[model samples]
Target: MDNPQRNDNPWFMALYIGGAGGILATYILIGFFAARWLVGMVEGPRYWIAIGTISGLVLGSFHIVMLIKKMMGEQDG
Candidate 1:
C-alpha cells in the first residue's frame, strides 16, 4: 500500500526543499527587526543585531528540524 503520510506527488518534495531558504530568511529578518525594535538601537555599535541573528539561527534550526521530521513522517503524536 502507498504510504499515507508522504505526499503521492514527488515534485512537492522539491517545493518544500526550495522553500526552506525563504523560511530561513524570513525567520532571520523577523528576529533582527524584533531585536531592533525591542532594544531601540538605530545605530552606533548595535550588538542586538548579532544577538537577533543568532537567535534567529537557533529558531530556524528548530523549525527546519520539525519540518524535516514531518516530511519524513517521524512526527510523534
Candidate 2:
C-alpha cells in the first residue's frame, strides 16, 4: 500500500498567505491614515509615538489570530 502524501496542496498555502497578507496590508494602510489624522490634530510627538505603538499592538494581535486559525485549519485537515 502507498502512503498518502501530506502538504501536497500548494494552493492551500497560497490561499492562507494571500488572505492574511491582504488583511495585514489593509490594516497597515488604515493604521497609517488614522495615525496621520491623529497626529495632525493632537499636536505632539508623544501622540504620534503612542499612535504607532498602538497600531503595532493591534496589528500584532491580528497576526496572532491569523496564525492560530491557520494552525487549527492545518490540524483539522
How do the predictions measure up, each by TM-score?
A: 0.77, 0.54
Clashing pairs in 1: none
After superposition on all C-alphas, the RMSD of every candidate to the true structure, in Å, is 3.3, 5.3
Local accuracy of candidate 2 as per-residue lDDT tens digits, 2-64: 334434478977886687777776776777667777777877565675677579668856885
Q: Among all windows of ten consecutive residues in candidate 1, which has the lowest summed lDDT?
A: 37-46
Candidate 1, residues 1-77, lDDT tens digits: the string is 54576785679988998788778888899888888886775664578878988899789878988888878776454
Candidate 2 Cα misplacement greater than 4 A, ranges: 1-9, 46-50, 53-64, 67-77
* lDDT computed for candidate 1: 0.80
